[model samples]
Target: MKRLLIFYFLFFPVFLLSEKRDVYAISDGKGNIKLFWLTSPKNYPSGGWRIEEEKTNKVIEKQLYCGREEFLNALKEEEKGLAKNFIKIFKDDDKEKKGKKFLIVLEAMTNWNFAQAIGIGYEIKDVPKGKVRYKIIGLDESGKKVGPHFLSDFLDSSVETLPPDAPENLKAEIILREVKLSWSQPKEKGVIPSVFFNVERDGKVLNLNPIIPSGEDSSFLDKEPPSLMEVNYFVYGVDVFGRKSIIKKISIYVPDLKGMVPPENFTAEEKSGKIILRWKKVENSSGYIIERSNLSNSLYEILTPKGIQPDMEYYEDSNLQGGSVYYYRIHSYGRDGKIGPPSLVAFAQAKNQTPPPKPKNLKAKVGRTMVQLMWDRVDFPVAGYRIERKAEGKEKWDRLNEKLTPEPNYNDITGLYTQGKFKYRVIAVAYDEKESLPSEEVEVELLDTVSPNPPRITNIESFDGVVKIYFEPSPPEEDVFNFLIVRGVSEEDPGLVIGEPLSKEKREFEDKFVKIGQRYWYRVVAIDKKGNRSDLSSSRDINV
Candidate 1:
């Protein structure tokens, strides 16, 4: 039931170069599986490794080669320069539990430490495609071996041949006697995102190890190829598991010194009103032929009238349907109208070509608290509009709306305190967030009509048979003219303002005029500089 099939190199590299020793598995298309791993240095002192299955506490005997006698006979065919010793499967004195078979491999004697890394290329024949649970544990010696030995976690390896995709668009550029091969990486959807490539010439591998893609392509230079004769080259992708993709083959005849090859680094991209196609200039080429195709893998139509001059390496195709993908391929011609071989196909999609018209009829309505902005909505379809604000003398304009405004209106309240000249502008935005020129700017100075919130009468103290009131001041402190302290005898009574209106800074007052045995509720009111009165504050009663 444990299902974690790490795609070898990407998640955990199949090469256990580090100290961890977990088993990795891969299956051939046939019913055979190869379980491979290197012995960790941490297990060198652990004497040996034992493969135990948790289900039956038994060993899959067919998967392992046991004993010096059996290992020597099996190695008769395999080359052997280094000699290693082996130890017994189990210790004599301590035998609490003993597995039936010697699950330990002959490479199991990790004590001396392997000079060369051990590979488990020995395939387990006739093994099932999935669910092969093998628990490889280091014989515990002290506590150092604990790092590599995953005692609790089972190696529930799902062994199957999930080969990586083959490299795409394999191309060969034949120059005289040399052949240069290039290929784009395959689009892989599995956990394994990348693979090293292998190139073969005439069924012989050119590279000993697999080659990794460098930039846009994986390339190889076959400097020495057969002269004049057509030689076939093959390229394939291989993952860390040693599983390979279907090989892509290309046949090429080495060209002479006078012969020209196709242009290199061919690319296509969408520019203003056209899809631009470009390629590196081919030396000594007379002319170039350009062909375009709307559908991939279909017949192509020559887009050029005669042929593009040798000096020009770029062509712009302006006659295109918007949002349609177009494929282009180009090849160069030598002096004798000898067309060079095989050009790479590149494609690009044309986009919406024109800019949207700028927003119009911008206007601003001034209010004391905020400026209400409005503009004539764009008649053409657009994503939305953006609002930006600027002060009178400031050259930089800051955007007021965080997101595009769906409607043609916005309310801005920021920076209204400073009574200064402000300017507003609206920009029309395209679906791709492309902005049009700013609308005609509108300038306005805000009017003063906002009122300050009422202050709260916090605590009213009655000590020594006298009542005193303490209140908190309301903001904006700059706008408040003064505080109005009101006194009321009952809930329904209209409070009377006491001591003509207190100073703006004053927050408390001693009510010496209150007679003994009198109860009264106190309230506070704030008036802004524009004479706008705030609502009365909640009342607090005092007893004398």
Candidate 2:
């Protein structure tokens, strides 16, 4: 007799992923998927994933991770703890040989109940060029088969992939009553599956579209810029396959009072920290309104909130941000309060009157082996930033970053093995290599943010109705707070923390909690003084 197996699709309807974020999938362009997703808040005892061919409906690979124990046992052990190891993105075939092990990337870094996390997912590689469906299930801890959640994601081998660069130099300028937006056309000209332009306003994309390429540029006009002064525009270049280019954003400022013959010869000159503006007077106008802004990205600030007298032909505007462009315009009005159209826009670059200002809001996040730092962006133009560190009680400061980091954050691994008092400072560097004053020093007393390494089990023995588990200590004996003996039916089960948490000096523990004619597998777990737990040691099984 031939037996048949079947999976009813209707029974698992709730597992269907209705959200795009169920499992984030992106193609590396080399036939592999880069995936990551949020962790469960319910602390499911077992979480699993299954990958199946969409058309053939055949499962290729799957895993049922009962907890940290099973997940750790499946992968290589690392000293950096679970958080860093969990969120790593792999691109090559080397990871495929490991039989699927994921290190815990974060533990203390996230509060599991609130700000949930998505990390340590499958490193699926060398996938065929077609549709692949994946399922992630969260099983309960109470021994009830009830599931807290199930996520089913459908990923095509063609997962929304695109080239790194978006259209270059996106510009938005005021063209009379309309706003003109344009970008450099694709170097290799094409349409549809190649590269085509799409314009989106506020957020809604225009369904009926038309693109006319004129020379090296393609442009679009926001026929109706919602009677607003400042509008944000997101521009994309999508192909026929629906894959999109990196989104370029533009903030366009459309003036309300416009179109009347503006003042002529309106000119602005850079003078230290201020811009000096002068313009020819318009006949029959008694007063004028002066406005200034950063380029054309934002609404202009009215310089003459109380109206400038016609006699004031020139005004000195000193309130400005360092190393930035300032655009200015003037409007003339009659005896009536009605304001006339704005004049020709004049822009000038403001110079750095003094040196760059001090950086602010320097903060640190203590990680397993390193401390990550972040600070607010400097308002002035900077080539990059330099970071310096000094050990507590040390008189000299040591430069930590060899090269100026273009980004505002840095990771300091300097006291990784030992906890100490450390101080850090940051400075801005101009493109000319000139340096700014160092920011206020931030001091941190490093703690044991890292866990101890997994211990190695050498021998196990059973006699007199008791089981003895022996392991070699990996951390300094004094730093170890205790050792836990985990006994389970299966070595992979993160079995109960049995017996008392043993002292640091003991390399072995005896377990008397057992039943006759039963089987048990034992493993060792260690904890450091600061309460960081080590991974479960390799297992050894014995029959009672």
Please count the clashing residue pairs in each candidate, in the order shown: 0, 8
The 10-residue segment of model 1 with minimum total lDDT is: 108-117
Cα lDDT of model 1 by residue, 106-154, tens digit = 2222211221122222344665454555554544444222323432222
TM-score of each: 0.33, 0.39
Residue pairs with clashing backbones, model 1: none
Q: How much lDDT does each candidate structure score?
A: 0.64, 0.62
Residue pairs clashing, model 2: 37-118, 82-104, 82-105, 83-104, 83-105, 83-106, 84-105, 86-105
Residue 148 in candidate 2 has what lDDT?
33
